[model samples]
Structure formats: structure tokens, C-alpha cells
Target chain A: MSTTNNHEPILSFKDVTFAYEPHVPATLKDVSFELPKDSFTVIVGPSGSGKSTILRLVTGLDKAQKGSVQNTARTRMIFQGGALLPWETTLNNVKVGFTGRKMSEAQKTHDAMAALTELGIDTLGDSYPRHLSGGQRQRVGIARALVSSPELLLLDEPFSALDIETSKRLSDEVLRIHSEQHITMLMVSHSVEDAVMLADRILVFKDGHIAEEIPVSLPRPRTITDPEVQAIIKHVQGTIPSSG
Target chain B: MKVTHTELQAKPRMTTHYWSHRGRRAHRTNLLHRIGSGLVLPIALVLVTGFLATGVALVPSRISAEAGTLLAALGASFLRLFIAYVFSLVIGVALGLLAERGRRLESALLPIFDVLESMPVLAFFPVVIILFLKANLLEGAAVFIIFFSMVWNIAFSVVGGVRQTPEDVKAVGVVFGMTWKERLFKILLPSVFPAILTGSILAVADGWNIVIVAEALRAYAPQSDKAHDLFGIGSILVHASSTGDSTTLLAAMGILVVAIALVNIALWQPLLAYAERFKFE
Candidate 1:
């Protein structure tokens, strides 16, 4: 809502249709969307509703079957499971995403340490991922994604596996990052509350299409009890199509 | 009376400290195991090295009915097994990785490997003789046979490991733009290490069993016995049994037992313990 009248989209998926297998029905049928700069958007849907498929396609992990996916912004994705390498320590894990690029070890180590430090995990840099807690591992995941200073951050149910307290803390951190760094954030979340808390706009998916795009024009630091936010949440809940 | 949420959480937090204490006990146990294994391996190594030295000192002809020749024969047999083991390891890793190329290939390879692995070593004799004997690799026929027995364990386990990699991990590879080299060295191999270690233990066991015929099959190759039969522990055992050389047979068999036991204690067990950290939770 704070975005200016910027006509250009940082990333766009025009008429995108995708399927995991050739024999299966299309998961996303002619879906289209353009994300504005420095905005937080959440895709809300039931399972197999193409919510995660959209996230994957954005990261080029799963290409669209028939459509144009034009991305001008440098992008990174944080996973649901944190996905840290079991062998590598926290610092080395931060360095994993920067594979094959031309950079000195010293520079990379410095950058990785700085990113870990930013995430409040610099002291645990030498510890292997197996030794870290779930929350700590996800923090490492965020550090890894942010190491390259990507313009757009894609989150694939990043807090689904976490407990409520950890989830809320991470949500706050994400909001801070979005506001302070001015990075475009697109998240796929099943929780209506999560969608309400962080998203500037919620794209409610039905079957294989985005059924409704609900906008939240509330000010920063919103709460569930806010009258306007409650109205938006109620609207979003009603807009979601019932699954069989 | 209602318990506070923090009060409830405190129970598990306290147990975490208890678990840490248990972890310290485990570390102490692990250190003891290390010391025990350390002592066993060097003694075993020194014995093996002594045999190796004896074999080096003596010519090929001197390997005979004497108990003195048993240590040297054990060394030669152990060497053949080791060489075969190394070959199997490389081939198995390659086959496992190759199977991961596509789903179709993977499906096809599983059944083929199953059939190949299930077939008895003796059953494959004609094919082995044809391939290895004609190739003139050595009593080297044993190496090939041992390789076959061992490679399957590794290949199958590696494929399984690759299959079990978490979806999120694979997604990370793509989102981060991981090169093939990085994926293999960092993610693939490290993740698959526990599997590889497990496979290797079985492979070495298989290698031990096959090394017998592998060294003794020289006569079947239509070469003269003295010229072709390699002076390995397997051959020594076979030769002693046939000729009723009881002293040499017992000594050679003893060496074999000690070698296997020592390797399990010193190498595989420790490696398995180390690889526990590599597995994806």
C-alpha cells in the first residue's frame, strides 16, 4: 500500500499454466500476476491449489508449461524446511547458495559471517546444522538467502514447520526486513492470520486460478484486533472457495 | 488450579539440560570406543605390515607349506581384496549416480541390479572366466568377482540416499543456482555419505567371501597351477585343505579372522559413528 504509482512490475507471470506431470491436470490454469516493487504479497490457498507451484515457478525451479515468466529482479527463496546442509556448519551453509560464482573465499566468509551476525546467529557459525534447533536452522536459511542481497525474496511456507512463538518472531523479522531493506516479498501461506499479518495483498486461490485479490490498506504494525484488519480478514475467509 | 504456559514449557526446558548430560555420557562412551579401536588397529596394522614385509623379502616361489608362509599369503590375499574393494567402490558410486539420471533409467536399473546382485558368485564363473581371464588382469579374476558382490550394496544404497533427499533441499539447489559440482560435493555426497559407509561395510564382507575363488581360479583359466594361482590367504587355505597341510590352514584361517574383526572394529564402526552426523533428520 505504501508503493508509489510504479507501473513497471519487478516480476511477472503472464498466462502461466503448469503441471508437475504430463498426464496430470494443470495445477495452475492461465494464472497471471505482476508484483510491484517493495511490496509484500501472500498467496493463500488449500493444498494443491497452485500456491506453492507459483512460488516454485517464480524461482525458476519449476518452469511454466505455457507462459512468460519475466523476472528482472535478482531473487532468492527461503524453504519450508530451512533445507540446510547437514554436513556444513552455519557459516558454510550460508556460502552454499553462492556456488560457482567468482568470489574469493575470504570475501565470501566475511559476507556469510555478516549475514549470520545480522540474523543473531554469528556466534553459532561453527556449529553444524544437525546441532541447531529448528528456529536456528530457519534463521540460517534466511541468512543464506539474504547473503546475495537479492532484490526479491520468495518464501515457500517458511514458517509452516515452526512452533507458534518461533513463527511469530520470524514473521516480525520478515516484516522488519521488508520495510528496512525495501525488498519485494512474495509468500505462500495457508494460515489466514499469517496472510493478514504480513501481506499487503492476499491472492486467494480456488481450484487452479486466483479467485480474489484482497488488498490491505492498513498502516504499519497492524494487529488482529484492529477493526479494519478484522474486516479484511473476514472478507478473505469468505472469499476462499470451500474444498470438497 | 491452572498452570501457566511458561510453567508447562519449563518442564521440557529442564529435560533439555538432562539430555545434555546424557550427551556428555555418550561423548565419554565414544571416546572410550575410539581408544579401544585405536589400540586394535595399530596392532592389526603392524601384523599386516609385517606380513607385507615378509612377502616383499621372499620371492614368489618361497610361498609354501610352511606356517611361515601363512602371514605372507594373508598379506597377498588382503591386498587382492583391498584392490578389488577400491575398484568396486568407484564403480558402485558411478553406477548409483548414473541411475539417478532419469526416472526411467532408475526403474530399469533397479531390477537389473537386483538380478545381478542376487545371482550366486559361482553361477557367474563362466562369464567371469571369459571376461577377466581373457583380459589378463591377474588372479585378478577374484578382484572382479569381489567387485560385483560389493558394488551392488553401494550402488543401491546411494540411489536410495539420492531418492530420500528432502524436496526443500533440492529446491534450494535450484533457487541458489548450484552447479553440478557443488551439488555433488556439497549436497549429494555429504547427504549420501551415511549410505555409502553402510554400503562399504557390506561390500568388504562380500569381497572377503569372493576373494577365495578369485585367487584360486587360475587352474580353471587353463594356466599352470604354480604360474596362475596367486599366493593369497584364500589360495593358501585352498591349497592347505587339498594337500592336508593342517598347520598352514589353521594359521591362514586365523589371520583371515583377525583381519576381518580388526577392520570392523577399527574402520567401519568408527566411520558409521562419524556418518551419523551426515544423515538428514
Candidate 2:
């Protein structure tokens, strides 16, 4: 695995509290965490446990009602739904990621193809979103996010929308990306198996707060069948509070 | 020995996966060719419109005096519709943006727009004429009426577009760090486009239907016939009907039908097809 060995914090949420409105109950309360550069962190919890909300906060789509959210790294998100612009071809949709950049149109197209090539999806460039399968669309979403060469990547339930086989395949590819590029990732997911497979750190959330923050130091190429991987998964599951 | 994440990355991105997506796009392109005989409609439209534009240029010089009068009336009516549609588009986009500014404003404005829009084309005309004639604005009476006909639906469509914008698309704007200007132009406007297209198509159809009644403003202000100068398809048809001039009436009817057809085929249909890309399927 490529090692950056940079221990600087890229993102921090300090005593942050968030709510959709005054009447609505808080989605998060007194949440605090730090994401160091070049690590893969996964937030895992139940449906309303504020996992996805944390990702949104990182992306600045929702401001914390109290405290502060500070980040030094440029970030991009791979949304749960892919969020591919329906009007554009896969290549064109990926190109929008470079909207503010000074790249020429030809360069945008070239870089977009290169990103797709990295995701193993260059052949799907000319196709529109409607023409693509769920797996293909998610790969396109990843390509769009990676094209910016962002220091941070946010993924909100990236595999919740995919099937079993596709999810496993995508999860492995994401693991490869982390091992190869060392881009800091903050992902929210429902899959404990995915957390064990990919994350360098696993954060268990309950009632809008972090219940446990566990560092994962398993060797590269860890599998669920491995005892250490299963032990981490079991530990994370137990750390999560009951749904009631 | 289990294949791990690193080994998986070495797996070839299978060619079979490309067949459905890449293949489908190629199939659709081929299908478009098959349906329209190699996409000749555009080439044909350019050739036809070019020839007509040239013929139109030589109207007074080459055409008969009677035909020229018909063409002139057609041009006048078409010009009014064009101007009115332009006004409608500007007002529609402006009002749409305004309506989205707040929930209270939308709640206040939407019902008012609905009530006015649902009223018949004639309901607003008499009031508008009274005001225009009182202000000595008889020349603009028809154009104003057409604007009213076209603006409401387009405005509502804009409102709907903003309200129904997908959450993920909004997140896209936030994540990409798009500025307010970029978000409005690139993301927000494009998200609202299919609705705008739908509204505009209906509004133009409504505009054409009402232009006839609108141009009969001369009936209300007979004393100002020379001042009003309401020369158009509506006026010609009105005159031909009252005089029982069968030949002129048939010619006017024929040209009106042809004009609406050409516009639908050339402009709206192509745009509607292009809008399929924004479906978010």
C-alpha cells in the first residue's frame, strides 16, 4: 500500500449540533471527530443514527446548528443515488466535476476519460445515465468525484443502492483506490461487512453521537473470513446501540 | 486462498458490461436514423426555411398584390406572437425565480396565477382593452392580451421545477462548491428546464389560439381603426369572414395551419426529444 505518512488532520467537527428546523429534533448533538489525511474512515449505524448526516455536514450541505465544522482539504462526495446529471452523457456528467477549473474543453474531456479509465469505466463515457446500469452509474459517480483530485472524499451509503454482488465488487475497488492513492475518505454505510473490508477506522454512531471510534490496523487485503476482520465486525456491531 | 481487494483490482473490466450501456446508445442512434431516414428532418428544415426566407424576402417584388397582402398579414400576426412569447419567457423566468424565494410568496402568488390563468382568453381582453384605449395604448392591446395567456403556466412550471429539484442534485451543487451564480445557471436552471419546455409548449399553443381574438381589438375601438393598425391573420380572417370572401378566408386558414405545423416540427418537437436526457431515470 502507498503510504503518505502525513498525520495532519484534514477535517474536524467540534461539539457540532444540527437539526433540520427548530421544531424537528436534532439530527446530531455534540458530535466531535477528526479525520486525519490519508486514512479511510467509515461511520456505521442504524437508519436514523446520523451517519449520513455526518457526511452531509462534511460536504457543507447542512450547517451545524451549534459549534463548528472546519476542513482544510478540498472534498468531493459520491452520493447514495449517484446524482449523475440525467441530461449529460457519463463523460459529460463527469466533466461537470471540473466546472471551476481552468481546463480547456478538450482537456476536460481528456481528464474525464482518464478518471473513468481509472475506475475501469472508460468504455461507458459516451453513454447517458438512463442507459447505464446501477453499477455503471456508481462507477461514473466515483469517476466524477475522483477527477477533481480532491484531498477528501465523502461517500453517503455508497453501496446501499447496489446489489450483493455489485456491492462486494465496488467495495473491493474502493479498497484498492484507498491502498493505491491514500485519499482520505469519510463514508457512512449500513454494511458492517463493508466497514471491516475497507475502513482504516470504524466509528459507531447511536442517538446522534459517536458511540465508539475504533482504529483498524489489519494488514492489507483483509477478508471477512479472516479472524481479525470478523472480530472487528463483531465489535462494531456490539458497540452500536439497539434500535429501540 | 481467497482473492483479496488487491487481486480484484487486477480483474479485467469485462467487455460484456459495455454491451448494454454503450450498445444501447448506439442502438438508439441507429434507431433515430432508421425512423427519420438518416436524420434528414434537420437538413430538410434548413433547406425549406432557407427557401421560404428567400421567397419571403422577395414578397413585394415577385408575388402578386393579393398574395403579398396575405403574406403581410401572416407576418404581422407571427411577429405579434413572437414578441408576446419573448415577453412571456422573460416574465416567466423572473416570476419563477421570485416565487421560489419564499414559501409565503409562493402560497400568495400561485392561487392568484391559477385563477387568472383558468379564466377564458376573452375575460381579460375587455378589461385590458378598456385600460389600453383609455391610456391611448390601442396598438399594444393584442400583444398584452397574448402575454397574459402565455405567462401563467410558464411561471408555475418554473415554480414546480424549483420545488421538485432532486435532493441529490442539490447536494451535487454543495459538494462541487458551486457558487450562487453557477448553481443558478448550471444546476438550478438545467434542473428546471424540462418543466419550462413543457410549459412553453403549452403557452405558445395558448398564445396562437388567443391571437385571433386578441387582434380583433379593432372591433372594440372602431373609431381608432387607422390609429390601431391591427393588420394580421386575425384581422384578415375577421374581414374575410364578415365580407364572405371565400378565397381570402381559405388562403388565410391554410397559411395559419402551415405556420403552426412548421414551428411544432422545427422547434418544439426537437427540443422535447432533447429533454429526454434530463429524465434522471
Candidate 3:
């Protein structure tokens, strides 16, 4: 047991190992990482590389069979396909994130609207998730997560369903929001390019272990065309073995 | 693709002008046409009901009073049906929830419910009558018969609905930190609403089907008399049919049909439409 201190990482996984079934091979084996306060990190790997398992562990959705997961920050997750309540309008969906809070209905509504406003989708508050386009749905997802004012935002391939153009635009919007809010963000993506563009630090997973950890010290608003960014992307891509 | 600057510029203005002018007029016409179309069903229902009422009124003098008597009987039957339906719904949902609480419970109880559901309610009427007679609860006995006929469908439907609740929806409840009570009312209940409604429709139909048998059981009453007999549409229909009074029987049957149609239109249809909003994509 360690004492709480300013120097401690906001989230830490110490030799964590997990499996869906006891007899099967572990999905995450002896996985360890630390996310410092207010850092933007991306976990990148190929499909079935256990990137999402790591996320599940961090969000406390799943438990590690061995070792320990220490998370101090209050966390909110944006699931793939947005996972917005189909029965609720965007405002109501966002308001649902504040369900356990001791707040008035008016306060919840105002906070939800404010979160949507921050994402520039306040006008869509009355629209249901089915009525919104993919990008719009993800924006509502972000607003839902942000309304809770969590210290850490976990994104599980939030933009995987969008077109490339929409994905890039949303990536920029997420980056801007990250900068403005100064909230710690940990995103799981299969796209190395997305990792290079958005993350301050990238953890590449392979065969249930961290293959490499790359630091992106490049200036803001990075592009794939940049030589340094391309080099890092290439390096990260090279770390994952091809299935064939 | 290539487009001339003039063509591109002119296309937008022409399209907007043409659409805006035609849109408002078309929208108004569509609205009025929709309203007219919507009124057709209700108008036809009213006309049919009126025709039936007139036919019943013009029946022979021997059964001239039968129409009014049948209507009163229908009202009485409806009251019993309502009570039985409400009782069944509460018990069914509670049992369904208990069954869904765990695999062992579901396995143990679901088969019993299935067997009880398959057995005809009439088979148990003798037992019900004897029990209620001993307790001096004849009305309770009749309602219990109807409740038995209707409850199984609702309970099974609820079990299916609970099982079919999507994994992601349940995950959302957990992630959002909803208490068990909140999860039950807010998530589980709303998620299963369509199933409950579907079951209710079937249960109501079953209730109507069994009401005649249930109310006409006065023939088996211990001290058979008008006082012992339940006065409802079922009892009147049975009496009319037994006496070979075709006019009274026909009028009573017509009244029952009209009553069912009215309840379907006024109650079930609107409820079904309202429940549609709770269904997940």
C-alpha cells in the first residue's frame, strides 16, 4: 500500500494480468503502465491485440486476475458507436450522466446544455440519437461524458464508425477540447496515424503486452505530412506483427 | 464533372424558388389529406356501432328488454374483467422479476408456469369453485378463474423481455452507477415495456374469451338461484341461448362484439402506439 502523494501517477497498472476464462490464455499479461496527470495518451494496436481489454481494466469495467490496478481519477468512458440511449434525446442522454449527483433537474439540464454548447452541438439538444448523424452522435457522446466533469476521459474507438473526413475533423475537435479542459484523456485506437496526431504519449500493444512506448513531443496541430510525425507513425506501425 | 458558372448559379435560385412556392401549398394539402384519411376508421366504427345498436333495439318484444339488459351485463362483465386483469398484471410481473433474478429460479419456475399455462383454466374451475364456496367468495372465485387464464402469458412475456434486454443497455446502467431500484424502474422496466404491452394485448383477449365461462359458472353454484348467479353478459347470453330465444341471444352477442370493438379502438390501440416509443433500436 502506497500513500497518496502529488508525485503518484493518476492511473497505474502494476503487472496486471487478465483472462476471460481461467483455463484460457490471458488477454492481458503482466501489463504495467502509468498515466501522469493531465496527459493525452493513446493505446494503439491491431485487432485482437487486447487494446480494449486494457481500457476495460482502466475503466474498472473488468478486473485484473493478477496484480493491481490503481486509478485515482474519476473516469468517464465514451464507448464505440456512441452508446447514447436511443429512448432519450441528446440533452436527456447527457443529463443521464449526472444521475447519481445531488442536483436539481434544472441544474442537470443546464449542465447538459453547457456541455453540448462546449461541443458546438447545443442546438441538437432536442434531437434523439437516431436522428443525428454519426459525427453528431459522437459529439453527444462526448457531451455526455463531459457533463460529469470527470478527471479522466476514456474513449473506446469513439470515431471508428465515422468517415475519414469526419474522423479527422472530430479528432481536431477532441484535441481542442482536451487543450481547453486540461482533462486527462486515454484513447484506444487501431489507427497509428490517429495516435501520432493526437497523443502526447502512445502505448503500442502486441500479444497482450506493451511492445513499445513512444513520446510525441511535436508541436500542436500535427499532420501526417510532417517528417518527424511520419517517422513515429512508421515506428509504431512496425512494432505490431502482421496477422498473415 | 464540369459545370458552367452561370448554370451552377442559376440552378440554386431556380430550385429554391420552385420548391419554396410548391412546398407550402403541398404541405397544406398533405396535412388536410392526412387528417381526412385518419378520420375514416373512427367514422366507420361509429357507423357500425350505431347500426348494431339499432338492430338490437328493433328485435321482437319477447327480447325487447334484452338489449338494455345485455348492455348492463356487459358493463358488469367489464368491471370483473378489469379487476382480474389488474390483479394478473401485478402478480405476473412480480413473478417474472423473481424468475429473472437468477438462472436457478428461472429454470425452476418457468417450467411450472409453462405447464400451468398449457392446462385449460376450465380444468381447475371445480377446484376454484369448491375453494371459493368454502370461503364464501363467489366473485373472488370468478375473477381468480379469469386471472389464471390471463396471468401466464404476461409472466412469460416479461421473462422473455427481461432476457432480451441488450448487453450494452445493461452496461450503461452499470457504468452510470444506477442503484438496483433505479435500474429496475428506469432501465429494466422501460426496456421491457413493449413486451409487457404485447402480453397485455394477449391477456386482454384471453380475459374476454374466458369471461363468458367464468361469469356463467352460476349453474354450478351451491344454491342455484338468481341471487347466487353472477349477473353479467355471460350469464344473460347463456340464459338466452338455453331458452332458445334467438332474438335475445343475437342482441346480446351483437352487444358483446360492439363492446369489444370499442375497447380495442379506445384503449388498446392508443396504448400500443404509446408503448412504441419505449422500444430500443
Candidate 4:
């Protein structure tokens, strides 16, 4: 969430293209972008516009078949689904995201707890993800991504499954965490309002290309109703099709 | 007025009664309930057929008491088998992980495991007897038989489990910078719990049958003894058949059947349930 000019770019995708099958066209077509270090960038697009694919590429889930993707910072991805190991508790799910770190068990648990605490669901640590509400599950996903102290966090529609009220609350919580942790975040979202509210720069992906990059330049502690956010929302709405 | 109040109470009570009866109907019609109920007819038929063919009336004497004894025997064997099973699991899972993680190594080694699995373990009797004789190792034959029954399943299951791990989950592990050891214990093992348990249970069941051959035949038993010295259920059945002691034969067979059934019910089912609980949708 740091939008200041002093930091370097933490990640870059230069003309990267990828496809599941060689015969099919690339899902992402020569897409390029830079994530300014410690800043929040949201990639908004119609469904199947390759926003999720970009996040996947950055996180190394799918390798870029063409062009290059360079990540200067250590990257961890929060899948759109919580992806909690079915057998583990919420705390353990968060802990899974930090496996093999040289930190002591105590430190790992402590860090996981702190992340959960930041999201205001510390008491639910012992509860399994199966028992949690959708919003709570997403919180576990976020805690998991952050617990690793990742330098770059990729969120693939992490809040899309929740109710609007819960999504807004979680968004605010995520923004607070971003400000506190100073982690660079690249989130894939469908909501223009979400992109405008949370991003330092909103990159609209269309037909696998970044059709627009609308810099919010809005003040910190902004809301959906902010004039600058509404203007960016309008601009993104204009550039991208209403239906995917 | 008092009578009217009593009638009102009785009306509510009758409605409660009606709902309770309706609840039973609902439960009985449920899919799980139907499956549970359907199990009764087939099992009863099998039991009746098996019992009638044995020609031994279900007597309250030793015949009934032997069921308890058979249960105890099964319990003891289960403990021993469990120990072997655990050892097999560790070794199998380790090798499985190796095979999965190292494709080239797996290709080189897998054919051997395949050969081992396909080779009828019964064929190894003479070789085991000869080896035990040469090595002056008592019980070596039994150990060989048990090991033969166990190793392949463990290895196969472990490999399957490791191979079946979802790509997304593995990617998560890599992103977290998990060491090889961490990946094996934390990610691979839990992910393959169902497969491992399934394989191990099958191996254990297979071991029971093989143990009968190893114990009853006693390839090196004295020629004059006529196999009567053997203490296993198979030996008992063999003796009973030759002597026309049909009741004893059926009793022994009953014990074996019961042992196998108890294992499937008490042990394998629970293991399967536990493993399944870990399985991701």
C-alpha cells in the first residue's frame, strides 16, 4: 500500500504469454506490468481476460510459455479458494503456508497467530476452515499468505466469494494489513469499485493485454464513495466491457 | 373446564406422536439408511449358506465359545500385523516418494516391484525353507512369508499417493521453500493418506492367507507326523477333512471367515474413514 516514489519495482512481467495446450492461443498475450515495491496494484478484468493467469504466472503455478516474468521480491499466492488442507485447523492451514522456514515452531505459530490477530479472528485459530464462514475462510487464506513474510503477495479474486458487506470489511482489513506490513500486493479482481478502492494503480486487462492503467493517486484511508475512486471506477467501466 | 384443558394437552401430545412416527419414516427412506438396510439381506444369505454347508448346528457349547477365542486370536495377529504394517508403511512411503520425486529412478526400480507383486508368494516356500536351513534361522520362513506379502503393497501405495498429489498443493509447498524432508512429511504423506491406508490394509489381509500356508504346510515337518503337528486353522481343516470330522472342519473355517470379517469391519473400515477424512474434495 506504499505508493511513495522512493521504492524500486519489486516485480515485472515483460511480454509474458501462456497457454495450457500448445495448439490453443495464449491465455495471456504478451502482457507486461511492473509492481512498484511495497505498493498495492489491482488487476481488474472481465472473466477469462487472464487476470488470474497473470497472478498464477507470478507465483510460479504456470510458467510463462513466451516472454519473461521477473520477480525481485519473494512471492506467495493466495488462491481464490481458501485451499485449506481439509484435515487441518485454521491455525494449521496458516502454518502450512510457512512450512520449512528456519524459524522455530514457536515463532511460526506466533507469526501465524499475529496474522490471524491482525485480521481480528485470533480466537478461531483452533477451528478448522470447514467450520468457518466464507469470509472467515478468506481471512485464513490472507493470513496464510502474509505469515510467510512474503515480499510480494498475489491474490486471485480472494474476496469474490463473500457477501458484499463481508467483502468490504475484509477489503478494509486487507488494506490495513498492507499498510502495516508494507508488502507489495497484486490482486486480480472483477469489481471495478474494488480495484478503485484498494489499488494504488488499477490495471484493466482486456483480451490478455493491459488496456488501461488508471493510477488512483487518491489519499490514504479512502472509501468507495471517494470522488477520485468513483472517477477511476467510471473510467475502468468505460474501457472494459460490462459483461465478460 | 378441567376436561377441556386435558383434551388440549392430549391434542398436542397426539401431534407430537404423529411427528415422531413421521420422523422414523423420513430417516428410513434416506439414501444412507437405505444402503445400511440393504446390507442385511445379502449378509444373512451368505451366513446361512455358509452355515448350512458346514453341516454343523450352531451349538451353545465349544462351537459358540470358539468365536470368542477366534476373536482373541485375530486380535493378537492384528497387533503383530500392525507392527509389520507400520514398518512397511514407512519403507513403502519413503520409496514411493523417491519413485515419484525421481522419475528416472522410479522407472529403473518400478519394474522390479511389479515383478515382486506378480510373483505368487506361495512359490517361495521351498526357497524359504532351504534358506532357513542354511542360515540355521528358526522362524525365518515365517518372516520371509510375511515380508513377501507386505512390501509390494506399501511401495505401490506410497508411489500412487505421491503421484496423485495435486499440482496446486505442490506449488504451494515449493513457494514456501519447503525442504525435501518437509515436503515428504508435511505435504506428501498427508495428501496420500487414503492410498497408503488402502494399500496397507489390503497387504495385511493378504498376509493372513499367506500365513496359513506358511504355518500349515511346514515343508520341513517330520514325514511321519502327517501334518497333524501344525496348529493353524488350515491345518485343522486339513486334518478334519481327512478324518471326516466335518463339524471340526466347519468350525475352523468359521474361525477364519470370522477373523477376516472382523478385520474388515473393525480395522480396515476405520482406517479407510480416517484416510478419507483427509482427502480433499
Best by TM-score: 1
Error of 2 at A64 (Å): 1.9
Candidate 3, residues A86-158: lDDT per residue as tens digits? 7777899898789789999999998998888877788778776666778888888888888877788898898
* lDDT scores in order: 0.77, 0.78, 0.78, 0.70
For candidate 2, list the clashing residue pairs, or say none. Answer: none
Docking quality tier of model 2: acceptable
Q: For model 1, how does the per-residue alpha-carbon lDDT over A145-212 read when each residue is reduced to its tens digit?
A: 98887888999898999999889888988998999988899999988888998999999998889899
State the displacement of the C-alpha of residue B113, model 3, in Å, after optimal TM-score superposition: 4.1
Please state every model's RMSD to the true fold in angstroms.
7.4, 8.5, 8.1, 9.3
Q: Write the per-residue lDDT of candidate 4 for residues B1-281, one digit (tens) a residue.
A: 00011222322222111111111111214334333444444445545665677654563376676666545644554554555567677777777777786657888889988987899887776677667756765345555667678878878987877777666666666667777777667777888887777677668767777665555554443342543233455555566677886666666665666556555545554455455446665
Across A75-135, the per-residue lDDT of candidate 2 in tens digits comes to 8999887988887778988987896888899999999998888777777777777767788
Candidate 2 at residue A196, lDDT?
79
Count of backbone clashes for each model?
Answer: 1, 0, 0, 0
Off by over 4 Å in 4: A1-7, A19-24, A46-48, A97-104, A206-209, A220-231, A241-244, B1-51, B58-168, B202-244, B261-266, B269-281
Off by over 4 Å in 1: A1-6, A242-244, B1-68, B222-227
TM-score, predicted candidate 3 vs. hidden true structure: 0.79
